[model samples]
Target: MSTLTDLRRSMVAEARRRQRLTWLISAVVLVALPWIFSSSFSISIMTQIGIAIIFALSYNMLLGQGGMLSFGHAAYFGLGGFLAMHAMNYIADGAIPLPVPLLPLIGGVIGLFFGFIIGTFSTRRAGTVFAMISLGVAELIAALSLIFVGFFGGEEGVSSNRTKGPDFFGFNFGPDIQVYYVAAFWALIAAIAMFLFSRTPAGRMANAVRDNAERAEFIGYSQRNVRMISFCLSGFFAGLAGGMFAIAYEIVTEETLNMNQSGAVLLMAYIGGVGYFIGPIIGAIIMTLLRTVLSNFTELWMLYVGLLFIATVMFVPSGLTGLLMMHGPAWKRRSLKRLLAPYAAISIPSLAVIMGVGGLLELTHFAHTTSMDDRVMTLFSIPMNIDSLLPWAGLIALFIGGVLGVRRLRPMLLDAWADANGAGGGD
Candidate 1:
């Protein structure tokens, strides 16, 4: 009994140590990143990433913990931004003597208010019914946003001057770097707060309701109440993200609260791994980077994103984090190295398949859409005319070869994985 007690204490101590270490590492990285990059564009992207991280985490609070699939989560986000913009404008007009940094809190309050109103009824049902209601509410608000031109500012939306607010320690936030720091600070605080919330009794009940609402009710807990709490909290954080977005861009347009924005956040959360606390953060960073970088190269970036989403759903339903965590057992068993060769062998063909498919897509798009003069295109430094058959044949051949290679090597890869995972292999 004494030995067991000592072992339990040691385990608790180790867990605390690891948790502290994680926070320390995260803090160091957050503080050092801006200085490490030190470029205007990099700073801008990082700021966007910070805002996205907050947004995605908020969505996770609903879908991941509460099991509420919201098709209109962006309603709160955009509304929050709209309110924050108005607040900023009020400060500029000398009607309000508030600091700009506190504007996000206003957004949060508004989000919580709306969430409570919506969730009051929406939480009565779960699954498809709740999802459809959320969608309807979103559409209603969107339409109302346009009709109420006095508040939503019509199609042009609203804009604000961040410089008009009271300065924080003499920093007027005129520079992007200052804005980046402010966003990073809020993001860190929001993330830590959300993490703590997940450990709370309400959060635990939310998960319980998510997993089994009927069972949760059998234990005298109100499933609707748990969901309402989660929904409200989720909305508040999402609003905070929206406020940051308004600050970052200095403008809020109709696009901010549209279905497209809602879909984008859904994609971010789903692709990031809704099951893990840090999954949305990873997803947000990857999605933001892809959006920023890929748009510069291809007009079919959305198409590619859609394809990636479908693939992730089919093959990696747990998202990128799930894929990473799949390797944990192998790592612990010290057999991960045994699978490296098979993985390498499969990766080359997989990459070839992607390239071939991309080439075909580009070729198809160029042929159907581009003018005659623009028909000639360069892919991987290889100039090819869309009017010709050689490029088509080459791409087809590459795809076929990759498919065949993957098919042939799949057994070996599976065997390697099984070995690494300590599964018995057949002769």
Candidate 2:
């Protein structure tokens, strides 16, 4: 019994040490990221990533922690953003004495206010009913934005100048780097707060209610209360993100509160793996890069994102983080190296398929969208004539060959995965 107690203590100590190390590494990364990508454009993208991280994590509080799938969480986000934009305008006019750094708090308060009102009714049910109610609220708010154009700014949306606000220290947030730091600071605070929330008894109860509400109720807990708390918290963080968005872009538009915006956050949370706290963070990073970087190069970025989402849902229901975590057993057993070769083997065909499909998409898109004179399209740094048969044949061959290759190699990869994970090792 003494030995078991010591072992448990050691395990707990190790976990604490690991958690500290992770936070330290994250801090270093956040501080170093600006210098690593010194361009203003890159800093802008990073700032957006930080905002996305906050938003995605907030959404996870609902879907991941509370087992509530929200199709309209962006209502809080948009509402917060709109109000923040208005506040910034007031600051510019010297109407409000609040500093720009504290603007997100206003967004949080607004989010909490709305979340309470919405959750009061929405949290009464779970599953499909809750989702539908959330959707209805979102649509109602979205329509109201148009009807009440005085506040929502109609189609043009509300705009504000961040530099017009009171300065923080010696900085007026006139530069992208300054805004990035502000965003990073808020994001760090929000992430840590959300993480702490997840460890609280209320948070655990939220999970219990999520998994089995009847069971939770039988244990002297009100499922509605648990869910309501989570919803409000989620709204606060999401609104905080919206405030960041307002500061970053100096504008809040109706599009920010639209169905598309809500859908994007959903994609971030779900694709990132709502099961893990860090999952939405990873998803936010990837999706932001896809939106800001990939869209610059391709018109079909949304299509690609959609395909990736579908693939994740079908093959990796646990999200990207879950997929990574799946290898923990093999890593712990010191057998991860054994799967490297199999992974490499499978990656070849996977790359082929991705390139082939993307190339075909570009080719077809170019053919339909451009004039006959614009027949040649550059792909992989090589010029290919969309009007010619050679490029089509090459892409088709690559796709077919990749499909065949994957079909042949999947079983071997699975067996290797099993072996690496110790399922086949008799350990």
Candidate 3:
């Protein structure tokens, strides 16, 4: 009958005893999660989310936890994916005699090998210089992706048939669902392992160096060593994510290790709230869902993503998870209900405006085969599907009204924030 508070107290009282149980529970959950999914689609989504979470978390180790910002994280991730694809090929070709389940380890070893080499130079210069070096390194490799046809498969990249795996207990992984099981199992394992890593001595030192390298140096902790170690570990996990990605997608390309992939990692980690351990996980899941679902609905999705990213930096600098964390105090105080009305009032119109604008922008650039010539210039999200004047008038009215309402509400929202922070009374 112990609650979360009770569990926290017990952990504080006997850390080891509770930590062991936590890990054991995690193991069970990872094993059972795939079984809980109703369909292959759900499992596939979960697999991607889990891999992305691992990738985001590993990236955060360098950026958020170690304060060593990297721009070419995909170097490790893509390197790992390419290696795994090659490994899968080798397995298929009978060049190597390893089981498919252990193919990811090959990717990890390859990533760690390069991570050490890259970290040796990059870790020495942590900030902007390091970022540039990483970017250069990534571009170099990405160019190689097009040149090295012998190894990289030149533009086409590489593909590995997972069906090449030997049957285990009659499970040949012949179906996508079976592949999901494999991916899900590893995804969960990677997540739990990465989380465990965050609690270790190295992880704590990484945090210390992140906060104050000078202070860490004074405490006899070598900042360079700490940074290098973090870089290597982060690379290993990113590689693991790449391996999962390769297996899930069954293809590895130069694009996999390109600057865009690297940027995606940065976006996922920061947008998820890199300040917290669990932030990247939330970010990855939400970002993956958005990438999957939203891309289907719009061609100009990247524009909105850019807008969202800018808004996050400008207003909600803490990211989505941070916003969710903001709700904790109200929940703790049992006073969330009192603020519900205003929150809904502000959110509804705000969301509407966003969606309306988003829809219009997306439709203008849509790449779908069916294009209608009957121009229905819908304004402000009021379905002007049929070429009509009403839509135009409605759009203008909505924009003016929305802008005015938001301007007036801005002061109220600010006051609410101040009141919540105990700066002033609501009256």
Candidate 4:
């Protein structure tokens, strides 16, 4: 028993050490990223990613931690952003003496206020009913944005000048780099706060209510109250993200509160893995990259994202983090090497399949959107004559061959995966 206790203590120590190291590394990366990327565009992307991280984590607080699936969470986000923009404008006009860096707090408060009103009724029910109510609330708020043109600013939305706000420590925050740092600071605080929340009694009870509300009720817990707490906190953080967005872009449009924005946050949370604390952060970064960087290269980016979502749901419902975690047992056993050959074999065919399919899609899109006389198009940096049958045949062959190779290699991968994770496996 003593030996077991000592072993457990050692394990706990190691976990704490790892957690600390992870945090230290993350801080270093956050501080160094702007310097490393340097470009204004890169800074903008990084800033967006930070804001997204906060938003995604907030969404996860609902879907992942509390088991509340919201379709209109963006309502709070948009409200927060719109109000933050207003605050910035007020600051600009000397109506508010607050510094620009403090705008997110205003957004957070607005989000919490609205979340409380919405959550009171929405949290009365769980599951599908809750989801539907959330949707209705979102739509209602979205429509009101148009009706109240003076506040929402109609279709164009509200705009403000971040630079007009009072200086913070001799910096006006007109530069992208300065704005990025501000976002990074808020993101860090929000992330830390959310993390701490997850470890609280309320958080644990929220999870309990999520898994078995009846059981929670039997134990004298109010399921609605637990969910309401989560809902309000989620709104606050989401609004905080909105404030960052407002500061970053100096605009809060109707699109911020639309279903699209809600859907994007949902994707980020689901793709990142709602089960783990770090999952949404990873998802936020990757989704931001896909949305910003990948969109620059492909017009079919949305279609690609849809395909990825389908694949994640069918094959890895736990998201990208879940997929990575699947290798834990093999890694622990030092049998990871056993699956490398099979992974490599499967990856080749997969790459070929993706390339072939992408090329075909590009060709189809080009043919439909462009004039018929535009028979020549570039694919994979190679100019191909779309009018010719040879290119079509080559692409078809590549796709078919890849499919066949994948079919053959998949079994091998499965077998290796099983072997690597087998009970008796070792280095």
> Is candidate 2 or 3 superior in TM-score?
2
Instruction: At residue 337, give the lDDT of candidate 3.
Output: 66
lDDT of each: 0.91, 0.93, 0.78, 0.91
Please give, for residues 46-85, the per-residue lDDT of candidate 2 as tens digits.
9999999999999999999999999998999999999999
After superposition, candidate 4 runs with Cα above 4 Å error: 1-14, 423-427
- lDDT digits (tens) for residues 32-90 of candidate 3: 77778757777778778877877888899888888887888998988999999988888
Q: Candidate 2: list runs displaced more than 4 Å.
A: 1-11
Per-residue error (Å), model 3, residue 114: 0.9
Best by lDDT: 2
Error of 1 at 278 (Å): 1.0
- Compared with the true structure, model 3 gives a TM-score of 0.87
Clashing pairs in 2: none
**Residue-wise C-alpha lDDT for candidate 1, range 40-148, written one tens digit per residue:** 9999999999999999999999999899999999999999999999999999888899888777888888889899999999999789999999899988888888999
Q: Rank the candidates by lDDT, best first.
A: 2, 4, 1, 3
Best of the two (2, 4) by lDDT: 2
| TM-score per candidate | 0.96, 0.97, 0.87, 0.96
lDDT at 263 for candidate 2?
98
Q: How close is candidate 4 to the true structure, as a TM-score?
A: 0.96
Tell me each candidate's RMSD, in Å, in order. Answer: 2.0, 1.5, 4.4, 1.9
